[model samples]
Each structure stands twice: as C-alpha cells, then as structure tokens.
Target chain A: MFITSIGYYIPDGRITNSDITEILVEDNKEHFSKEDIEFLTYSCTRKFEFLGIETRSCCSEENGDHFASMAEKAARKAIDQAGIPPEEIDCLIFSGVTNPFREPSFAIMLAHRLGIKTGDFFDINDTCNGFMKSIDVAGLYLKSEKYRHILVATCESPYDLKNTLKLDIHIENTDQIDNRLSGLIVGTGAAAMILSSDGGKGRITHYGEQRTSNDWDASMLTLPGTAVPGAKYGDTITGFWSDGRLISSSLIREMPEFILRKLSEWGLDAQSIDLFIHHQLGNNVTFALMDKLNADHQKAPVNTFKQFGNMATVNIPVNLAIADEQGLIKKGDSILLLSSSCGLSYALLHIVW
Target chain B: MTFDEFKLMVSDGLGIDDTLLNRDLSFRDDLGIDSLSVINFLVKIEHKFKFKFDVEHIWAMKNLGEIYDTFTEALNNK
Candidate 1:
C-alpha cells in the first residue's frame, strides 16, 4: 500500500514526570510521610529517567478531546490532505487500542461523525500494531482491484481509562507503584493514514508476524481490577499493562531473531534497513531491541514515547510524523516498522519512504 | 526468609544465572537490572515474604548482601 497522506492528533494536555510527582503528593500527602514523599518522587522520576520518557500527552477532559473526537480530527486531516471527501474513501478502518464504547464499533461512530455515509467501515483490533497490520491487509484489497483509498485511523486515551470508576478504587500505599507509574508513563494519541495503490511517496511491501505467549500475563496494558472481574479486552485493553522489566528482558532476547528472520525473508539485512520504527513501550525496550538487532536507532524518530508516551496503534504514524518533523524522512528512504503487544504479538513491515 | 532464598529470587527476576548469584552482585554493572526491574523484583520479594521494605532505602543498594540485609532487617522489625 502506498501512503498518500499522513495526519496525527496528539492531545493538548501535557503530563510530565514532575506533574506525576505532584499528583502523588496531592493524593497521598496525608497518608505518606515526608520521607515517603521524597521516596515516591525519586522512585517515579528515576524510572522515567532510566526509560528516557520525560513527558507525554493525554486526552484532556477539560479540553473536550475524547478518544472519538480525536479520531475524527485526525481522520479529517488525512482526508483533507488527500484532497478527497469522505465519500471517496473506499475503506475506513479504526485500529484503536483504547476503544471508547462497547456496542457500536469505534470505526462506525467515527465514520458517522465524519459524515462518511458509505464505505467498507470496520475496526482492526490488533492492540498497538493494528495500524501497520491494517495497512498490510489494505494492500491485499487494493491488489485485488477493489479499494482505491484506504484510510486507517487510531485513537487511544490512557487518561480516560485511568479515570474510569472501575480502575479508580482507592489504593492504600505505594505497593501499587508499578501500575501507577505505568499509568504516568502512558498518554493518548491518534493518527490517520491514507493508502492507495497509486505508488505515492511510501509503499509497504513486506510483512511478518509472530506470537510468543510464554509470558502472556507477565505484561499487559490493563489490570484485572475491581471495576470488572473476568472481563477481557484483547485488542483494546484499558490503561497500559507494563511489565517493564519482563518486556525489556524478553524483547532483548527475542527481537534480534525476529528482525533477522523477517529481513532475511525480504532478502535484506540490518544494514539495508533505513529506519526501524518501533513500538515506544519505553526507551528501554526500544533501545534494547535496536541494540540487539545491531541497528543504529540514533536518527530514527522516537520522540512519541518520550514526548507523547506510547500511542498504541497510532505509534507508527505518530512516530513517522516525528521523523518527518525532524527531516529524517525523505523520498526513496527504505523504512521498516516493528511492534509488540501484551498478547506477545510481534509484527514487522518493510516499506519505502 | 533465608539470605540464600532472597538472593535466588533476585537472580531469577533479573534473568541472572546461578553462577552470578554471588553476594557482591552489582545490580547495574553485573545484572543490567534497571530501576523497573528492581521495582518488579522487590514487589516479588514482598509477595513471597509478605513484607514491604522501604524501597527508597533499598534502591541504592550496590550488592546482593546489602539487599539481603535490608530485607532481613525489615522482617526482624515486623
């Protein structure tokens, strides 16, 4: 699939590590000692410092930027960039990691809101890798000579998930720090990409996927808390399930093999890879993967994780924008995307920019 | 919990092999255990022994013996 246009929506609300330190101080001042407060700040900030995430953006309830609204805003940008009305959109796919509603698919709601009455509208629930995977699927339809303009959108709201009444039960102390710190590291993001077979500036040509479920419950984006027990949301998990240590260790051990396998399949090597866009789980995971692959991610755009946290499905386009913003992307640059999720699903895509 | 048992959990959580389970194991230099790994490891230790040591005091620990001493003191006080 060739990329005709790319647009992204990052919430205006900014949450920094210091902001989290303030939040913890406000929420637990009465329960914690001065020493505890100092410890909490160090404990939280030290982790982010190590992970290389300084700030992130999330949906601002005060600003009225909910997940669906942000999705529409991003989709509009891509549609506008393509210089085509929503009616011309052959396929509208919503690849959201944090769904806003249950009954009606987020894609339908977004399509309706954008005044897109007719199209093959659906949702691809692939956790964080949905956007790129959806692009791979779109190529199949485009190759068969059916779809002309395939538009994929992603909207994630970790802030909204954290505020849910279900996940908001009181926590007695800092033992829950891992979950809470993970929450701090998460922010919402959305992006829209218009793809076509017209051979535009970008074309994704190769794809690979794998699942290693040995440590399935070891890391996740959501916690099975009091709000709902026994409930499951595989594609759209609430909050960020971060087994930072486990993910760091596992990705280091396995990602090199995955990268080499996919690259070899495409008759390429790590040196031939121009850019390896990765899931911004954190700085630690991304660097570990790159280091193991023996690839220099120095010029590769990765501001989304440090600046906007993990955007889930929107990570690829958003990170691409980060690359474009840095002038890292140019015509004819070889590109690749790598992603991993809690299901332990891993995907790699070879594209040209 | 015995010192050996506590050391074993740290080594396991960090994916450190048994040969590296010496008393002077440095978290950063030897194990490459970042802050998050240490937090997860400490949480696991808390679950096993049912005691929450002050993470602030223990995070700066440089060796396995100091880590064991920290937990030993926490259990003793309890």
Candidate 2:
C-alpha cells in the first residue's frame, strides 16, 4: 500500500497566549509563572480571532460546518496531488477527538462534501492516536485487493469551547501548577491524507501498538461533552478539575519504552529513521521522547507548539504536510509516526517515503 | 523606552509595519498578534535587548504596553 498525499488546514482566526491568559484572569486571579504560560500557550493548537460568536472559529461549538469545510478543502487538495478522482475512492475515514455532531459520522459528511459516494466512510474517536490507527486499518483494506484508493482525514478544533473546556479548567487552576502545566501545550488543527494501492508516492512499512490502562486516572482529563453523570451540569454546578501532570507522567513513563520496542521489532534503529513525527503533544514530551529514543532533534518535524500549539489528531499530518512542502523528506526517507492517547493507547507507524 | 526604539524592535522582530505601533493599541487585540508572532518577537527581543523574557510571562501579557513593560523589566533586571 502506498501513502499517496497529505493536506492540512487551520481556521482563519488567531489567538495568542496573552489572549487566553487575559481571559483566564477574569475567573482566577492567581498569577501564573512564565513556565506555566509557556506550557499552556503551547498546548493550544489554533489562535482564533474574535468572530463575534460565543466561541472562536477553532472551538468545537462554533460550527460543525467549519470542520467539514476545512476537512473537505484538505481532502480535495490531497486527492488532486495524488492524481485520483473523488469517485475512485473506495474507503474514507475521519478520525479525531472533536466531532461536530454525536450522530452521523464526520467521515460521511466529508465524503458527501467531496462527492465520493462509491466509498465506505466512517469516523474514529481515538483522540491523539486516531490517525495512526486509521492508517493501519486502511493499510489492511488496501492489502485486501478489493479497494483501489482510500482517503483518511483527521481534524480537531481543540480551541473549541467544548474541547477547550477541559483545557480551560486545567488553565484556570494555575495554582495547581504541576497538573495544569502538563496539559497546557496541545493545540488544535485538521489534516487529511490519501492512501492508494496502485503504488503512489509514499508507503507504509509497519505499524505497531502498545496499550496500558490507568482507568483510575481516566478522570484526569475529561472533555465537556462527556456523558459522565455529575458533569452533565454546568461548570459552576460541577467543579471542573483535571490533573494533567498526572496524565503526562503516566504517558511519559510508558510511551518512550513502547515506541523504542516497536522500532526494534522492525530491526530498525533510530539512526535509520530520517524523520520523527510525533503527536505534537508538547515540547516537553517531544524532547523527552527524543532523548529516550536517542533521536536527533534536527531530524524531527517542526513542533507547532511554539506557534500553532498542540492540535491533537491533526498534529502528525500537519507536520508531515509542512515537511513535504519544505522538501524535508526525500524519496527514500523513513518517517516514524507515534502517538499516545487518553485511553492509554500508544501507536507507532513507520513510513517509507 | 522611546516610541522610535519600540517601533524598531517590533518591526525588526515581527516583519510588520513600524507605523503600526501605537502607544494605545493592544497587541493581542488591536494588532491581532498570535503565538507565532509572539515567538518571533521574543527572538528579536533576545537579540536586541540581550536578555530573554520568561516565555510564560510573555504568554501572559495582553497588550503592547504590557509587552513593552515586560521587556523593559527584563532588560532592567538583566
């Protein structure tokens, strides 16, 4: 199976770190340290301008159409670059943490927008690791010889109030600096990639996963839309609290070793890989993972944390597209994509360019 | 800092118009500055002032006045 094309999009609005900090001070007066602001600012994936809406354009509650619109733009670009027609697509997948509606998969909406009716479309909610999982599933379908072309799209407007609510809570409780600091670096964005069986541009070599559960810690980071009973009420009614540092500590402890083991299984060392495209969770986690894998810092894809922030699922593909645009990857380069999600799911994929 | 000096710093840092710098304008709102712009400004600030402002502190600043104040404070402290 070949990885044909990739595309990404971010909303027009821009929100700086200072913008968020100014808003946070209205609810909580506690002063945040420079480290705290850097971590939190880096966590946001998008910077939305004031559009006179309840939430910014990047927020989940702003509009479902925006997500669909951006997803369609990226999908169209990817298909065009791959030199494939929309109707030729056999399968389409939309995976991410933020979805416009609970019912009717976003993939179906994307497929409709792209005018691709001859394909099977679905959505995946694997959070950070969704893209890698979708790649594995698409690869299997490609190997079946029944499908000729597949489109995998992942989008997350993490800046949305629905999604940002979790981040907002973590940021508001700045006095609990340790926990809030950890979750503050993930930003919001969207990405799409086309997969084909006809030997296109890029190819997937191997995919692996390692899972560990911290069910007790599952409540550490809860989105506002969750069905958790007590949380059904408003934020004032039910005190919003999450220990992000606790979650990151667990992830940091488990992920590096898991990724290293997966790479070793393929008999490939860090030096063999040309680029490392991680989840874009944060600068800290990225550096920590690099140190563990003994990977060179220069070889890693540009981390948008300092710019766009953490964009959850869109992080990987956005970086990939930017690298591609900058000619960062050559014909035979090996790219390693890894992600660890909230369910304690860790996934890794090796791509041969 | 003098207005001319501030305009030079922001222009050299953000690659935007030096004339855009108004004493009353808010950087976060009026100028529509984002994180990337903030980072670019920080890099230039470090080079020009020979000091690094705390990124988190910089992240917490809202307007141009606040940024100017922070930079001055950092320079003074340095």
Candidate 3:
C-alpha cells in the first residue's frame, strides 16, 4: 500500500502579483513589463505577509521549533486519515532541504510530537527528491513482515536565509542574491504520507534513480547552509547565491536524458501516465522538462512552482495532497512522481492510485 | 537639488511614510535600510537625477550621506 493518507499546509498570507509589481515599481524605475510581471504572479505562489504562520511554525520568525510544528501537523492529519493510532506506526522518516537544528534528527522530534513510540525514525537530505525517496524507503520498510505502518514527512523553509546573504554580487545583469533568493518562492510547507503493508488506495509499482555527478556544475546554485563553510548557527552567513543562467543551461542539457531513461525503466510511454507530478523547480525548468518529454500538459499536475514555490523535498507530497484535495488524482489512476535534487541525484517513482 | 526633493524621493522609493523621512534621519538604523531597499533606492536616485550608477559605486555606498555625496560627485563628473 502506498500513500494511504496525505496532508499539506500553506501559510495564510497571500502575496498577489499586483502587490509585487507595485513594490518593484516604487523601488526601481526599470519596471517589469505587465505581461512578464503577470507571468511571475501567475506562475508562482508567494507569501506577502506572515498571517497564518505562528511563531512556532516551521517558516516562522523564531528558530528551532518550526520543524517540530510542521511535523506534528502533517503527522496528526495523516494518522487521523489512515485511522491509525500513533503507536501503530512502525517507521517514520523526515525529509527536506531545511532542518531546524544540526543534531537531534528532525524525524526524532516528529516521532516525539506524534507519540509514535514503536517506530524507527530517520531523515533523508535529498532536498527536492526527498519525498519521493522517503516514499520508496517507507515502501521498502513496509515490505518487511516486521513493519506494518510507516509515516514520512518533509518540511522546507528557506526564507530565513534571505537576510544573511550579501545582496551586492552581480551576475549576468541580475544580482546573485535576487536570483538565489527567487528560489525561496518554493514556499514553506510540510507533507505527511502513510504507507501500509496491506494494499489500499495506491501502490508504488516501480522506483528508479540516476546519478550524473559529471554535471556537478549544476550544484553551483547553493546557499550557505549545513553543507557549506561558515554557516554555523548564529554566524549570520550569506544567503543563497547562483549563476541562474549557468544552472538553467546545465539542467536543460541533463534532465531530458534523465527523464527518458526513467520512463524506459518503467516500461511505459509518456502517454501512459494519467497524472505527471514532477518537481517544483521553477516555471522555465518545468516547461523545459515537459517540452522535452512531449508530455500532455493536461495529464501533468504542476502546482509546485506556481502555487507553492519549490518547497524542495516537500514538492512531490504537497503536490500530491493538493491534487487529492482538488480531485485531480482518482482511484486507479497512474501517477508519475519525478524529482532532481542537488548533488545531481535524480529519482522517479510510479504510483497507481 | 533641494534637500526637500531628495528627501521626498527617498521617502517614495523606500515606501516610507513621507512624514517620517527627513534629511536628518540615518538610512541604515533610522530607516532600517537593507541591501535590497538600498539597491531600489539607488535605482530611484539614478532615475531622479538622470544618471547611471556604476556597480562599483553602489558597492562603495554605505549610507544615505555617502549615496548623496556619490550622486553629487557623479553629477559633477558628468
């Protein structure tokens, strides 16, 4: 059984395109063309205010406690939906680009929050591919006769890094900070999924991964987080910085071949997928990938970039839960989950709902 | 340019209430000017004065007074 239950949360503040356009115009005389501004507004969901976000929320102003809150929200919702008590959960996984602290795995805090006393807990650091990998891991765990129920949760919040980065670096006519900061639009959200041994609403039929470290050039788009030097807590480091043009060029070159290989592994054609749920990278990247795959836009549900920014690892599950809420995915429909993370890791999962 | 006009432009550009801004207030601490807000402020100053800011000049700027001096120097140089 796969994804017996799924839940997601988006902060309440709504930042409309008009608000951004107005702010930009007043801030700078070089105004965005109305069409371009509208494209940005319609293409990505952004937060203009912090209304619904609590002080303890994952994306909140405070630090360290946000991840626990996100995990609790998603865990409680999924457990309730699955009709299982917390004690019955056998395994728990936390996946995301951002964690609240360095030690005490976010999964441990989540297990504590959910009161899942009888589960093995761990975390995966795959960023955008996190949810897909966590799903695959949980599936593998459930295959064991010793495990019955597994819960996987992913939470991402990149906004705090915005203030730390020096905004002065200019790369290709755009500030490196702005280009890097634009990645922040991939909103802050958490998603939890419940997997069971008994067959239910959905099943993961196949999984595949392809690594292309030769294109490590794509990893240039990085932030000063745990992976980088001088990024320890309270150090006040630079935020995200990137050569957007360079990253875009490399992704275009690498992703088409990656997608084709994954599709081939599933022994399925692009037309066979009833719903294509891919990573929420950005508008341009998503369009480029779909164009290469010759995917039917109708079959692909891409709200990740447009509605929730990128949410890194939370992209897939958040998209899936939104689809479930919107009635986009029905029982017995074939859904394709694909993601490409930093470190040049690519993964694909085929789920039959 | 008159200080009043420069103050008005700064107020409009930074989205600060016009009444709260004056030539006496410091941009960084008083206005809480950030790098993004400063970049936007420079863009506004360039348009208002009809001059382009060299990337290096922007990097050198630390405060409103420095920006004002730089703008005047660029104008005089032009």
Candidate 4:
C-alpha cells in the first residue's frame, strides 16, 4: 500500500523539566523527605537529559483537544493532503494507548466527526505498536482489493499527571519517584497517514515477520482489567507504570537478532535502508538498535524522543511525517520502520519511498 | 583493555570507587547501577573494545565478571 499523505498535530501545551518537577513536588511534598524531594527534582531533570527528552507536548484540557478531536484534526490534514473527500476513505483505523473512550471504538467516533459515514472503523490498542499493526492491517485490506483508500491515525496523551496521580498515594522513597517518572516524561501527539492502492510517493512492500515474546507485564497503563487481580470492574490505577530496565534490556536482547534475521530473510542489509524510522521508546533503545544494525546517525533519525518524548503509537508516524517534511526522505528511497512495544513485540516494515 | 583499566574506566564512568569494582559485584544490586545505566555501560564497553558483544549473552550478566568475559571472548577465540 502506498502512503499518499502524512500529517501530525502537537498540542499547544508544552511541558518542560520544570513543569514535571513542579507536578511531582506539589503532589508528593508531604510524604517525601527533603532529600527525597531533592532527588525527585534532580532525578526528573536528569532522566529527561539521559533519555534525551527535552520538552513534551501536552494537550490543553480547556481547549478540549482530547484524543478524538486531535485525531480528527490530523485526519483532516491527511485527507486534505490526499486531496480526497472524507467519504472516499474506505477505512479508518485509530491506534494508540490514549483513546478517550472504551465503549465505542475511538475510530468510530473519529470517523463520525470527520463526516465519514461509511467504511470500516475500529481502534487498535497494542500500546506503542498500535500504529504499526494498523498499517499492517491496512496493507492487508488494500492488498485484498476490497479497499482503495485507508486512513490510519493515532492521538496519544499519556502525560496527564492529575488523572494519573492517586490523591491518597504518597511518595515514600526515591524508587517510587523513579518508577513514576515515565508517565511524566510522556508527551502528547497525533498523526494521520493516508494509504491508497492506486498512487502515492511511498509503498509498504512487505511487513516483516513479527516476533513476539510475552513480556506483557513489562510496560502497562494499569486499569481495571482481568490482568489486575483485585481490580474491580470500575477500579482504576493512575500513571503509566513500566519496568524501564526490563523493557530496555529485553528489547536490546531481542531486537538485534530479530532485525538481522528479517534483513537476511528479506535479502537486504543495513546499507539498503535509507532511513530506519524507529519506535521512539527512548534515546537508549533507538541508539542501541542503530548501533546493533551498524547504521549511521544519518541513516536513522534519533532525536524524536528528545523533541516529543515518546508519543506512544504516534511515534513512528510523526517521525515519518517530520522526516518527509524536512526533506530527509526522497522518492524511491528504501525505508525500514522498526517498532517494539508493550507486548514486547518486534516488527519491521519495509517501505519504498 | 586490561581488567585494571576496565575497572578504572567503569569506576570513572559510574562514579563509583575502584575498590568496589569486583568481578562478582552485581552492577544492579551491589553497585546500584540501574537498568538504563547498564545499557549505557555496555555501549561504552562496545565502543571501547570496538567489539559487538552478543546480545543474548550480555543480558544474562549479573556482575562485572560475566560482562568482562562476554566482551573479552574475542581474545579467547583468537
């Protein structure tokens, strides 16, 4: 399937290190010691620096830029760029971690708002890997000749400190502070891409074989579910909890061979790929992957996390859009989109641009 | 790099004392180096040695000795 157009929207709210520090200090000041508070202040800034995340985009709740609204704005831009009427979209796939609704699928609501009354609409929640799965599924739909134009969009806003902070919870030690930092550094972003069977500048030629290990508990936004043993139907837990060490170590251990295997299986090499648009998990994971692949800094765009934090499922698409806009990508150039997420799943999609 | 040199390098990189840098000391448990730091440390080792350590073998390391052994395997093979 060919990518006809790409667009992204970052909210007006910009969060810096100080902003995150303020949130942590204000919420947990009473429970923390002066040393602990100092650590919180220093740790937040240091972690941001280490992860290479400078500023994160946060959605203004007042402006009402919820996931659905952001999805609509991004989708409209993609649709407009595609130069196709909204009704012409054969399917809409919304993938991300922060869909505002669980009852009605996010894609259905977004499709309605965009005046797309017809075509298939649904949501995919594979955490950060949602968008890749969406594109893969879209490719399937387009390849079957049943769909001509498919719009895939993602809006992620996983940095809501207020909602994530349980009022009763108190920071007891530096470890507690460390674990919660992941949620604070997360940024909000939305992106949309229109893929068509007919014509476009980029074509996803192959979806690399997916390799998955059940490290499902590694990273999670805990909510009331069957997985949470005592979590009643209405119960909820705030914040995105992740074992940063586990995820990074697991990914590094798994990704290199998986990527190498895929390249060998596909009869390609590191030199054949123009740009390795990777999941913006963090600076560490991205650089490690590039290092493992023996790819140069020019071959991969490594600063997306620095600019936008981890936009979750929107990470890869936003990177693609930014790269395209910045003229980093050229027509007929081969691109490899590498992604890994909560399922500890690994996938590579080859696109000829 | 020699083991003494490696110990000095890690001590400097992690800001820990050289006396604390023993082969059996767990970087995570004893040295207090978290997960992320371990990756950075491994990257530094790769750059310093100019050898790509096997990913699977390295993750199994719990102490400095295993790491040293994994990276220095080229010498053993040679």
TM-score of 3: 0.66
TM-scores, each model vs. reference:
0.78, 0.69, 0.66, 0.80
TM-score of chain A of 3: 0.77
Regions more than 4 Å wrong, model 3: A15-65, A161-184, A215-237, B1-78
Q: What order do candidates take by TM-score, descending?
A: 4, 1, 2, 3
Highest-scoring model, lDDT? 4
lDDT of 3 by residue, A1-87 (tens): 566888776554343444443444333334455554443332221221111111111254443435557667877888898898888
Model 2 quality (TM-score): 0.69
DockQ of each: 0.13, 0.03, 0.02, 0.15
* Interface alpha-carbon RMSD, every candidate: 6.5, 13.3, 14.3, 8.6
Query: For each candidate, what is chain B's TM-score?
Result: 0.80, 0.75, 0.66, 0.82
- Candidate 4 residue-wise lDDT, A161-191, digit = tens: 3364342223556666544655766788899
**lDDT digits (tens) for residues B1-78 of candidate 1:** 786777677667777776668878767556766557775666556655667766346645778888889888988887
- Chain B alone, candidate 1, TM-score of 0.80
Give the DockQ of candidate 1. Answer: 0.13
Number of clashes recorded per candidate? 3, 21, 6, 1
Alpha carbon deviation, residue B51, candidate 2 (Å): 12
Regions more than 4 Å wrong, model 4: A61-64, A160-171, A209-213, A224-227, A230-238, B1-35, B38-78
Q: Tell me the tens digit of each residue's lDDT in model 1 across A207-263.
A: 888887676655455443325333332444444445555665566666679889889
Better of 2 and 4 by TM-score: 4
Candidate 2 per-residue lDDT, tens place, B1-78, comes to: 766788787877667698878667765446645333455446545655667666446544667777788777877799
